[model samples]
Target: MNIKKYILSFFLLISLSLFSQEVAEKRDAPKPEIKISYLDSIKKTFVRDDLASCVDSLWLKELTDLDLYNNLSQDIQTINFDEQVDYELPTEVLKARLQEMDEKSPFHIEYNPGLENIIKSFLKNRKRAFERLMAISEYYFPLFEEALDKQNVPLEIKYLAVVESALNPKAVSRVGATGLWQFMYQTGKQYGLKIDSYVDERSDPLKASEAAAQYMKNMYAIFGDWDLVLASYNSGPGNVAKAIRRSGGQQNYWNIRKNLPKETQGYVPAFLATMYIYEYHKEHGIKPERAPIKHFATDTVMIKKQISFKQISDLIDIPIAQLQILNPSFKLNIVPSYKDQAHYLRLPQDKMAVFTSNESKIYAYVDREANLREKPFQIVRPIVPQDSINTLQRLAQAKVRYYRVKRGDNLTTIAQKYDVAIEDLKKWNNIKGNKVAYGKNLRINGTDVEQKLSAVAKVEVDKKAVIKDSLGSKMDSFYVVQKGDNLSAIAKKFNISVADLQEWNKLTNNNIQLGASLQIAKNSIKEDVVAAPERKDIQYVVQKGDNLGNIAKKFGVSLDDLKQWNNLTTNSIALGSTLIVAKNEIAIVTNKAPVASFKKKEEYSAPATEYYVKKGDSLYSISKKYPGVTISDLKKWNNIKDEELKPGMKLKING
Candidate 1:
């Protein structure tokens, strides 16, 4: 009996120890922290009228105008209201249909009377518009889906494009938002969309979709809520934040709707309504019209030389309008060519074989046409009647003068100085922004006020001449650094290279101080023989689309060697400028000119790493993956003049 009691006591002690250990483990474990969503963070920082400033008022008006939709579909017949049974469905049935769609879609398709009315309007009265959108969707939705998929964003986001641009690649909002994605100039540049004289990549379906996907992904990362993402996209994040604050710290989109901008409040509903109509158009007796081009009907090829759309259309017997539709990115109908980069040309899939076979002939035709147009076409204006000559002479003669910008000066201040409007100043100088730099040259038209000040200016001019004469001829040849001057512009102005400017000034960076003196001449000595005897100034008139690389190639010189001799920091050169091309003082006797060669193999320090190109990859984008690799370096390494990258193509990324 004593042995049994001791065994029971031992079992009880073991149970107590195990229970105590479990309690200790539980106490030591970490408690999960309260996580705050992005919307909540925005609520804390929201302010009134913060986003209203960025939104374009005209764009808002356009969004709310129902007639725009009708006008967009004038070619199609409008659906008769009495014809479709679904259009006459009771509110209860419509709500149930929306509920069913909401349950099926990944997106939150919230139902309300406002959303229902929009859906009804689209289905009943605007059937033609809906049909047109459906037809265009066949061509554009696949591109959008591909881009969104690469970004890991929801496929439903494709509907946003329909609301933004109605599937028009060349759509532009009144506030200067351009292309399918409706990007402003600054935003487009920030997203790597190139806008230049010849090309506007923001209008290219493929490129714009990629930029849009990236933008949406960035917005989603910040807001976390897809509804809020849509609102922020329409009204900007600042306004959304402000709305959240005004709504008493509400993070939900519907709760903050009252505080949001009028357009933003409707933007989400429109997107949802568009989504619903697109998904259930057949149920509403709406049929999609046949699209001109199918998603897979087109193919892309890289063009090595600059070519015009007219040239391609004329040579290939393709309609110019169709070419324009297929390739809307080429502004002015010109495909831009650069020395180190190539442009892409899109053609119908069936025409690819013909295009490839006749590539040489097509390029030759373009060159011949270009040569023919080299001589200026003189327009013989009908001789103006002698009676009109006096009236023409009586018209005010506009005088032009160059003004130097000073420190602490802005466009407004400069405009005030010239007694001209700021808008006029911007127009004259091609100035896009308000900020002006010190020591920049501005062209000012002589106003009546300036004419009044001319006598005073003459005195100042005389004083300046005296000061200039005091300086020796060598000093007189130097240029004073201006407020708006950059190395490239300065080099272009003085017909010298940025490298030369830096060497003369001992500048470590591109920054130049205002009023600083820079030597413009190659030799300090007045005598021409003291200058490098090997160097000769050659006048090369820059043709349309010509670049420094091409010029260097034509002259049988290395790009770097050309830059060093010319003191150039960038490859940009002004048209019709004489550049110093340095050659050996001793002439080499050879029948053939020396061909440019690559640098010694040892000079390439980076190891070659192979990378397989993926969808949406360009030479410019791919170069960003490897350290120390540049687009130019990639082109040189691969013998690639065209910037296009194909999926599954292997490239060497030297790093």
Candidate 2:
């Protein structure tokens, strides 16, 4: 009985220890963190690396918050990448989002050999660009998600940007669609995107996302089908609507795909392919190579004056490239004033304190020094004085501020100087001309009452007056040449018919080489095209005593004409060696005599006995007889047009 009890006690103790260990193990076990996953069959099947190296291929699996946040170092600590992923997607939320997308998207899966080949070609050409796409994704994706959510659009459609620009913010397409979202200028304007000198908000990830969401929402109202909506976004609603009509009002994107433009034909497929790649990046071995993005950790300040990236770089010793990445809208490296005529300046979070401290100094520096270097990827200046003020309106009374027009003044320059527009200046001043004379006082800003008052009162307050010549006419038009520019676009800018431009430029066919100068219109100013003075066929060099005036008179040419012909950037000529005075076939013999005898005489006569002035001659020529007898002394002796003299007129010789 005693042995049996001891054995039972030992068994009970052993069971209790086992139960305690199990409890400890349960307590120590880590709770599973939920992660989203998608199968990537293409990557898995095609990537032929060894199984041992598969871990290297498992990009998404290996991805950490730091990996996602690599591009945004300044804000790395603030962004909770894992938290965003950890945030559970409610079934209802997923269902609603997906359902809305299905109702509005324009993409459709199709098997077309032509489209397939295009995709293949694009994929092959843009394989390396995927890294850029990945880095940019972090910046754009969250903004797109928020916009789509607010508009009740499908979040998946956010991938549309990849299809549009490969996530390159400054991407400009052949059709003139710009920014990552690929908004045409007109469409971008319609969506309330600002596109001017300093900023094209269409390229701003946040702003473009908002515009895209609203556009997608609008498209949904038209198609009521997500695929059709997407199709509309790619090819535009008019094209999609036409395609739908051509397809007998079919609501399907696939049915309407055939009616789309060639690019649009592949657009949907490319979007789908992009979505597939993003979803299964791990399987495809297309690991995203995240470039370090400094802007991820940044703060913005409103700049009231025109500021340049170079100013920021110089002040903070930051590279211009860094500032450019942070502020993409600045065309020509200048940040345009915001809606309040202030510019939004972005700086790294750590540097924000430093930037704020030097804000006044920075602004002063920028204002004081106008010769700052520009960022490479900055926007091209579409209009002259793009970063300057828009002088489209004139100054009115209460709103008017005085501005002095400087040298090289014009309506555009004055307008830019005051941040107004030329058109506005014209309207305000009721002036038809775009010229602003130097030293001209301009009413740069004022109210309508001030404009009326100034006009009625003819207020001529003591200010430098602009001298309007009223002599020259305005240029008919101008054209900006782009890469691969053809005659068609050039013709459009001048407002004269394309046929006229072709005829004006003597382009026999539509073909024209890039950078080739072409005349757009007859020049309004009839400036004399001074023919290069005729070079003498006979050779003559300066003897020690010979001067230009004597040599020119002997050669039967003007001194000015000799100065022009010898390829001289200056007036001085070499004593010996032949110059291309005339073509070899053309021999020039002066009506007076050949200059060879005069050139042969090495000995100099003390000076001329006397001098005579011929037609179109001047006292300067007569004075050449006496060393140091300037035209001034000659003019003092004669009642002349200063030095001017008529032919056969005698002058008193001082020699």
Candidate 3:
């Protein structure tokens, strides 16, 4: 689970954020009653005015860069789907299956050699991609279903977004179509979607799904056929009309298929293929890799005042990237509060109460920040880590060897076996004292080699490692005093007498600076078995829904250690905003890993084809272009020694 949902799930057990002084209301404050559902509520909020009248020069001025790089929807639009994939399923089996699907679906689903090619192409080339797509679909499909139902569009029409934007809300097309439903500027405006300096309803998942449904309804009114409505949606009704007329007034989409635009011809087939793959992916052994958070796990709230994502992130301890993902329509990263209209901040369902209670403090922080600034509001962007790339890259780049711990094998044995020093193994694996846990991976290295392999994960960082008193009687290891820490706890943590601590630091009283660092003697550290925290404090403030045990494990500390350090008698911990994860602030890592197997993707493979590299091509790009092809394969195939690539370079791909 992500911090968002993980915190959310802890609501019944504890309300972490609300307990802080920053929050305004009572502990058991009454939750504001939601009178109506979100689906019903949105219909009343949509504007009746034409979109063009609402847009102005300022709207164009705030335009951001096109986020089209590496988008699936863009690739599909330009690529020839018919030629991209191949399948050897018997024609009779496919025809029979399609015939069955046609009976149930409102859109045309009859067997065509053209449709067959696309379906097989997806199965052959996009099994892994589709599996991941299906995972993402979980978060979106529900909202699409609700919005589509509200607009009276077919539920199956939800699949259209897969083809339009691959369910990516921020997706922008080369032709300037934008959002999950790929609405053009004019069309988006025409459909009453708000677009301006601070907002783009086109990228709003719920709003866009609603608009797409309404658009489909209008198109159906013109063509009286769902298939033509889809074709009209892509190529426009005028083009569909031209195609119909050119096909001798044929009402059937297949009969008029030849007359439609090139993209529209493939668009309908891609949509159908998506629907088929989602429905029968299990038969193909493709399994969904679930999204980080489910849609139902989230909820939305109207902000009475304007608020920036940074403020919410700062106050709630949720990542700004996560906030943006949950609420993508906010163009300027600010949720503006309109006097006459309502604008909401969507968050995990459990955070609604916490946000409502602390709404005043959040606004006050914004005011204080504004008042403190000598100039106009400046972007004090937080230094967030680039976590999209996996840590496996770090492990791969460390050029290190690993050995699984066996029974009765201590760090000394492993160090000796690898011909490395004992202290090197301790520092390398973040081990404390001489104790190494059984069934764990340890890094063995020589003292000449530098330790600390860029740290560990939310799965836990080894911080409790006992640094021995290399000086014997003198203090050798240091314990930087953290906030809420006292002399008593520090001595207990280091297994040293408080008198010794006071003597070494020359302190008369327990009072210490929050920023002060104190040296600790290794004394009896040989018996110490846990790691400790370090500088660059990675404190995670408990959100509304968080569990202490999970937090403890994530930070690589024992649950008992956390309670003891915090002086807690009960199971409650979120007394303050800072989570106090470790002495060293750990990098935020997503719990959702990439899907390794949709029933083990290794079990399936498509036939590979050769390709020539185009301008701006690299080995990585080429590998991404073809599923099941890795950069390693490219190096071996071309016999290249390095990552250098030039135009007109020939490479082989094997799936």
Candidate 4:
């Protein structure tokens, strides 16, 4: 009798354990409230909108009270459909199901499941979500397939994003894993997704997909098991490894799943269900509302120049949403340079012509607005290892290919010292014949290697140059220190090495103390002064949604320069007040060439040109004006942005 009683107790405990898990899942869900009136409203709208119509049939009776009760009993800890059993479920039954789904499914979870709505009125709410998912599938599937294939990853893993973000690019988890793939900043950074003051490339569909593929591939290589690979993705590899250790070295994910984190345990199930939903959506009465994917035939446009999203939007008729969708890497709505200082601009097949024709015009817009800031573009030279003494020596001996324009250095003297073509230097730096900045660094040898080598040599020279220059201008110097100035960012703006900045300021502490004025000598005035109330050494309040870029931009400065000026470690800026900015002065570029008209075509005069102006133009138009101009001749002569042209525009003849 004792043994039997013990056995019974053990079974009872097992039952209770199962019951608890079920109860936990169900506690958050309630019976959806159904209204017959709401159902009728949906029916009317569906017919009006010419969407799928709902016809009430005897099929409503198919799910009897006994069936619901039985289902409820099986999952007793779940919603109590058994207790609510009745002959005819009032319309509330439908409402209850919708409500239960809204809460129980991903729709109401912290992870975004698209726009939220209480769709219990009819099957339409769930139907709409399914349809939207299908439409998005067209765009995402191809990209996911390509990335996953390249990484030799399982195609099924692409469905993981559906579970994580439901295809929402802006989805943010409770724990702050953001973007379509829902990667936390640290994790995304680990996988090489750049998050910066200007952009978070992890949110980009193409980039994030590639990152996800690579991450999954790495996880697979680590565990050699797909299930474990998934577990690692959910809870991280460390957690999975821990679970395996706890499970006495079980290699299989399922064997160690019980030992895994609770959230991770649910993760696999959720992923599987999502996959099923994605693949067999039609079986679940879901139809895709296809939002046609806008096709773009784009090429890489190297923007050694800085540009803004607003500028692009204004230039092209493409909506901001479309551009943002195309390039999710831009964090502050500004695209930074890719490794080559280039960015891929995805333009639609038709709009490419318009973009190409107006390329320079768009750039001019950015240039004028961009330079309005008091801070200039900080040229951040990649660091060289000091241990490479031989490399540094060679670089030093390579005849310093860059000349830092001094108060006395002229183009002729600079050209003679470097033994370079003055025209080449001017052309390389986009100088319009004779104009140059006093403190600008100009390239002597336009070769890439020479430029790289010269920058290294200048590291030592730049430091000395800054100190000597500072000391030489001592009579013109004044030190005014404000809040939040850092050495590195400041040095970049001034075109001085950080070491030189420290040496010149005698900053023994290596910290720029607030309210302390550091010395600035003559020739320190790289920019003109703009009048504003002095900072008064007061704390600045950060305003709402104020990021580093916005704050810097608001003060007419560059982000890196701001960090340097303020001595910041991170670019985090919160809303509601102040930051130390150059209120007393503004950097102004007075020597850049006024906007010129090398690319814009103001006139077109040929039968073929009509098509260029109105609808279409081939390369033949150039020959009509200049004669003996082949299609290649025209391509070479006009510097036409793209191969295509709209009707109207003077076709210059190529020689």
TM-score for each prediction?
Answer: 0.48, 0.45, 0.47, 0.41
Q: Tell me the spans in candidate 3 whose CA falls farther than 4 Å from its real position.
A: 1-71, 78-88, 375-655
| 513-558: candidate 3 lDDT, tens digit per residue | 7646676663322322222322333334464456887667555577
- Model 4, runs deviating above 4 Å: 1-127, 294-300, 337-340, 371-655
Q: Write the per-residue lDDT of candidate 1 for residues 23-132, one digit (tens) a residue.
A: 99999989889897543443344232211112233422322333543343331223222333345757887778788877876667766766666566666666877776
Each model's lDDT comes to 0.65, 0.55, 0.66, 0.54
Measured by C-alpha RMSD in angstroms, how accurate is candidate 1? 31.3
Error in Å for residue 519 of model 2? 44
User: For model 2, how does the per-residue alpha-carbon lDDT over 380-410 read when each residue is reduced to its tens digit?
Assistant: 2222231111111111211345665555777
Ranked by lDDT, the better of candidates 1 and 4 is: 1
On lDDT, the leading prediction is 3
Ranking by lDDT: 3, 1, 2, 4
Scanning candidate 1 in windows of ten residues, the lowest lDDT window is 587-596
Each prediction's number of clashing residue pairs: 10, 44, 18, 41
User: After superposing candidate 1, which stretches have Cα over 4 Å from the reference?
Assistant: 1-87, 375-655
